[model samples]
Target: MPSTRSQVDTLESGLPYDYTDDEFDPDYRESSEEEEDEVPKTMQRDRAKWIEDNVEDIEFLYRQLMRDGRSMFGDSFLQTGTINTFANFLYRNTTPFSEA
Candidate 1:
């Protein structure tokens, strides 16, 4: 029977770990190989076009935010749904927020 120390030492990870210096070295990677692993850049659409397309929804949401602010500021709290909707709108409009 193995001792606790021996049992612990013999436990298998089953992953390849005994790589040679040359095998997993970064210098061995070709430029193309590194490039292939990189994330591709996404193109930005026109904000004006986005606003134009989503005008009704955006205006409705913006009005709701403003109304809530006017009536609730220091008087009442906003619902989590309202805050989440605003946050999600900001998240989706990345280019506009990133510039700010």
Candidate 2:
């Protein structure tokens, strides 16, 4: 385990401002299991509208960061192609998607 000083120093680096409150809960980091729970009708129905308002700005920042990160390392498309081939190998061996 890391020492407390190292963990506390993480905040001095300036975390991204767009980090969501939803991710704070360990349960909803993301969901892949059956979401049997339904949203109550009383809740605001404009949730999609709210997300639409900001998603583009969020995506723009994400793309900028990715671009800057790539420039810093000077990586090549071959790196992605190699990863895709490896993923295909794993998926083909493990799932019916390969047969289709």
Every candidate's lDDT = 0.52, 0.45
Per-prediction TM-score to the true structure, in the order listed: 0.32, 0.26
**Ten-residue stretch with the least lDDT total in model 2:** 35-44
Error of 1 at 34 (Å): 37
Model 1 TM-score, all chains together: 0.32
lDDT of 2 by residue, 13-45 (tens): 686445576678677656432231223343224
Number of clashing residue pairs, candidate 2: 0
Best by lDDT: 1
